[model samples]
Target: MSTTDCIITSSVVPDELRLNVLPCYLGRHYLTGESMVYDWAARLCSSYEGGHWNFFTLSNGGFYMAPSNMDRVHVRWYMNGYSDMMGADAFGITVTLFALCHLAEHTLDDVIVTRYHQLREFAVHHAEAANILRAID
Candidate 1:
């Protein structure tokens, strides 16, 4: 595994006016292992550029299970060598707040809103699916 394998970033508006938003990206095989940052986030935010797939979506409900015969992409909430604060769980949330302070100069308002909705909808669907599957088992 790479050293920096998990990273999260956020975009905050009205810096002083915090909102109840949880913008996060959970990159499994999606993220490169060497850095604590995901391949997609690094590419999107222009942080990392060693990936073949540049366009990745954070709106796929966050949970990605490996299809039959495919390589496993673990849902990593934290790395073994990292501290609690540096964990994906903690970083994901923290990056959201920290990102707010540093807004992308070119990021559109509509785009941000749309992405937020996507994240929310996916979260709901993913949760329901998990519950249904759990009940079935």
Candidate 2:
């Protein structure tokens, strides 16, 4: 990808929404002063199937799966199977977004309860981000 094929904005989400797609801002720092990406990863891991998400960090890139599927989980072509940084980050966001949308659908059907506030928050944020991205597109 060329340098120009990227987006460099003051906002991570489409607009300036802090709690947009992600549970928290990706660019912020936690109380430990570490990047919020770590916390985001943790939250994503905890988002579905009672925190059975398995996140593996390989030398190339990382991939995650819910319900601890060993045979079903493998690195993608982009993971080398892609980049150690970009690939992992991309897959992490994809997984989080997928979980959020999937749960949101079931929640709408009243199949899933909002017992976990994190899941509800993620669904709401992802919805808001999707609407903003759609408008931008």
The per-candidate count of clashes, in order, stands at 11, 4
Q: Which stretches of candidate 1 lie over 4 Å from their true place?
A: 1-50, 54-70, 79-110, 126-137
Cα error of candidate 1 at position 87, Å = 20
Cα lDDT tens digits, model 2, 58-130, are 2112112223322222222232222122233233434443443444354452312231223223323332344
Q: Give the residue spans of candidate 2 off by over 4 A.
A: 1-86, 109-137
Q: How far in Å is the alpha carbon of 8 misplaced in model 1?
A: 26
Candidate 1: what lDDT? 0.27
- What lDDT is reached at residue 44 by model 2? 37
Models 1 onward score TM values of 0.24, 0.23
Model 2 lDDT at residue 117:
29
